[model samples]
Target: MFKRNKTRRRRSSRQRGPVARAFFFLVKAGVWFVVLSVGWVLLYKVVPVPITATMLMDPNGHTKDWTPLSRIDRNMVDAAIAGEDGKFCSHHGFDTGAIEKAIAHNQRVDRRGRGHIRGGSTISQQTAKNVFLWQGGGYVRKAFEAWFTVLIENIWGKRRIMEVYLNIAQTGIGTYGAEAGAQRYYRKGAAKLSSIEAARIAAVLPLPDERAVNGATGFTRRHGNTIAARIGVVRRDGLDACIYR
Candidate 1:
């Protein structure tokens, strides 16, 4: 009984207070950091600030650095709407139908150990991720992105959302947005882009910061033509007509 009591006392002594408190404080701080980071991500996309590339760099060192959506051409807007989210103006932040189809497709692929991957994330969701969070395929980041996306959609509306996305989205190494991208790619202002020029810009959206618009590569040319072809349809349809009207 005495030996048992001595052992118990020794174990109690081993559990010190300072180390435990420090560990507790660290955990608490970590939780708050995540909360704040997520909050900042949500705010950054909705608010207009010339956020210098946090993840990617602008390599070209062009003089026309930060430009606004008002400076961008209608054709560029049309091309972007056609290529990325055809339903941008209509959806209420989340696209239930598209998400459902994507889920079904993913399941089918998963079962067979291989299949074509599908993504139903809308322009808002993409904006949320690009503006606030890092790029990757993780459930936690995606979940947070979805939450922030909802926040922005509810507060900013279509015009502001598009505005933020256009400004912040990386167009090249150090270049960002249609305005900056236009100058970098074509040595022209965004407001002056022609249909074909706008299409070329849209073609590089998926591979921003890497793909060159003036590369003279077949892939770039072909993709540019494809985007150009779709511009007429989007323009005639109205940018938000499908979703809004």
Candidate 2:
């Protein structure tokens, strides 16, 4: 009886407390997340991304052609910087100033009923979210987006990130990438895009389903024209130097 009691005491002593068990579980999970995320980023650094969650989930179906950065026109690259992220070449991962401005704009818009939502996401953040995450916003998704943004910024660098972003981002109702957008809109290849053509495509990027790349009107046309003009300024000011360099 004493031996049985001694054995029971030893077994109970070996068992972990609830707090200890939870701590160990979280530690294990964190380690696995780090390992797997690093591996995924490393894999994509060398291998072209085959597809993304956004592509698979698009209800309108999708078209894509993976045009290498070298094949894509310089105009397209400049348009993307001008139309989307003006400071793409300078920021690390997050753009705090843009984020702060977006937050303030959103707060002000919220009190005014219906209004356009301003976004502060950088190209890196967009690429990370588009490649590794689903559409829509939530704290959990935002957390994951931040995690992957850091991973890509560290692993892929600016050129690769921009390359992947241009290829993966939704450019129309069913079109994905500059190559597909160019073909669908103008019946031309991405490599042959002029500044105006590229800017129109870039203007379509923010709201691909709604914006018309070919005969854009209203905000889309105005935005495209603005971006088209800025393409030269982008080159002149070297705003897109990182990817070009």
Candidate 3:
């Protein structure tokens, strides 16, 4: 009976055409992808993420201290929302308005051949990219970003997303996270970061290498100041209510 079953299985395998084999292979691959991606998201929900693709790929050596959200200052959260994603608490991963605005802004160009390029990525999207995906843009990356964004928004929740973002986000050249950035810039911990310090770090987040947090000048300084002022508004207006609640 065993030999008969084995012979039948072998015969079935031999009968499959190239197209049938390819379809089965794709189906198996897709199932594995969903299972692994979902498991990854679930695992990170409670666990402090150990590492990411971006961290390993950085040419400059990375420095990071994985401080939980409780250890990080509230002002830091406020500053991030203010500086990066105002609708972080309200939106479900993506902000269509910001994307539309960015598209419009990027479309407008002056006499030069080069045009201004701006991104509408939110904290959720950034966290998605920082954690599950790689750096840079392309349709493929964008699709993956959208997939991971949905996974995190559904699995990790707002607070967890914020915690991960604050911890993993590149704060400066080779420096990662609020804790490491605080120590590098202020010789202090993230828990003790002031509004200005937090805002400065948040301001430099988008282009950490280009912006200076220690003595930010020009656009960096101005953006930091703006975020600093908006921090209070974030708290007052409950822009960070989802996380707090």
Quote each prediction's TM-score.
Answer: 0.71, 0.94, 0.95
Tell me how far the alpha carbon of residue 76 in candidate 1 is from the true structure, in angstroms, after superposition: 1.1
The lDDT of each candidate is 0.75, 0.92, 0.94
* Global local distance difference test of model 3: 0.94
| Better structure of 2 and 3 per TM-score | 3
Residue pairs in candidate 2 whose N, alpha carbon or C atoms collide under 3 angstroms: none
| Decreasing lDDT order of the candidates | 3, 2, 1
Predicted candidate 3 versus true structure: per-residue lDDT over 1-245, tens digit per residue? 99999999999988999999999999999899899999999999999988889899989989999999999999899999999999999999999999999887777743344754778999999999999989988999999899999999999999999999999999999999999999999999999989999999999998998889976899999999999999999999999999897
TM-score attained by model 2: 0.94
lDDT of 2 by residue, 141-169 (tens): 99999999999998899999989988998
* Backbone clash count, each prediction separately: 4, 0, 0
Comparing candidate 1 with candidate 2, which one achieves the higher lDDT?
Answer: 2
Poorest stretch of ten by lDDT in candidate 2:
12-21
True-structure lDDT of candidate 1: 0.75
Q: After superposition, how far is residue 87 of candidate 1 from its true place, in Å?
A: 0.6
Q: Highest TM-score among the candidates is held by which one?
A: 3
